[model samples]
Target: MPTLALMWEAKAAPGRAGDLLAWARAQELDPSPARREHFTAPGERVLVITWWPAAYDAEVPELPDPPQELRARPVHRWRFEQV
Candidate 1:
């Protein structure tokens, strides 16, 4: 079976990057992925990457959006299959 990687990115509002990062790290997916990672970048961006052993289009659990007050903009997401 192919391994699918899900990427979720979001920017925090003003000085709330720590809060957003903490919230993202604390999320628990129902059927947890095989692997998960969290990272932060410049401009208060938080990136989460989860790897699953499933089809590209399979229904997988994803992190839900954080509270509006913690975000600078809507979250961004993408999915990819390991070649």
Candidate 2:
């Protein structure tokens, strides 16, 4: 099986970055281990990266559903195969 990575870009609301970080941490403990990492400079932006083993089926099972709060923010995702 191939390794799949999901990447996201988002901007946090004014002084809300801490809340976002807490939420992300809680999410990592879910059934799916989605890890959150980012750089905060030049602007309040966050990048989320998730990885899982890919499947041959049309749909992937390891990938977790996006959180509702994250949906409210401007976000983008990209799927990539491991090198």
Candidate 3:
């Protein structure tokens, strides 16, 4: 079967970057993914990526949204299939 790359990104509010990072680190996805990675950027942006061993159009699961108080804006999500 093909694999899909799922990504979720969120920007933290001022001075709340560390809190956001900690929260992201503690989150666990249900129906677990094949592989996962996390990243942090300068503007307190946090990203979570998971590789799922399923078809490109599969109905893969997603992580829960972070609390409103922790984010600068809404979260963003994307899905991609390898070439």
Candidate 4:
């Protein structure tokens, strides 16, 4: 079986990175991934990467969008297959 990695990144509103980070951390995906990682970067960017046992194009669970007020822009997502 192949593995898929889902990446979700978001930028937080001014002075709200902490809140956005907390919100992202609190989100739960049903049938959780095999592995999950959370990251924060400069400019209040939050990135979450989840690894799952599935194909690259397989439909899988992903984190939902945070409240609009908490984000500076729309969320960005991508899926990649383990090579």
RMSD per model, one decimal: 0.5, 4.2, 1.0, 0.6
> What TM-score would each prediction reach against the true structure?
0.98, 0.61, 0.92, 0.97
lDDT of 1: 0.97
- What C-alpha lDDT do the candidate models reach, one value each? 0.97, 0.54, 0.90, 0.95
Residue-level lDDT tens digits of model 4 in 52-83: 99999898889999999999999999999999
Residue 45 C-alpha lDDT in model 1: 97
Return the TM-score for candidate 3, rounded to 2 decimals: 0.92
- Which has the higher TM-score value, candidate number 3 or candidate number 4? 4
Any residue pairs clashing in model 4, and if so which? none
lDDT (10s digit) by residue, model 2, range 1-83: 67777666555666666565555545543346334354444355666676666632324333233455543365666777777
lDDT of 4 at 16: 94
Q: Give the TM-score of candidate 4.
A: 0.97
In the range 1-83, model 1's lDDT, one tens digit per residue, is 89999999999999999999999999999899999999999999999999999999999999999999999999999999999
Collision pairs in model 1: none
Off by over 4 Å in 3: none
Q: Flag clash pairs in model 2.
A: none
* TM-score, structure 2 vs. true: 0.61
User: 1-83, model 3: which lDDT tens digit per residue?
Assistant: 78899999999999898888889888887888999999999999999999998878899878778988899999999999977
Query: Candidate 3: which pairs clash?
Result: none
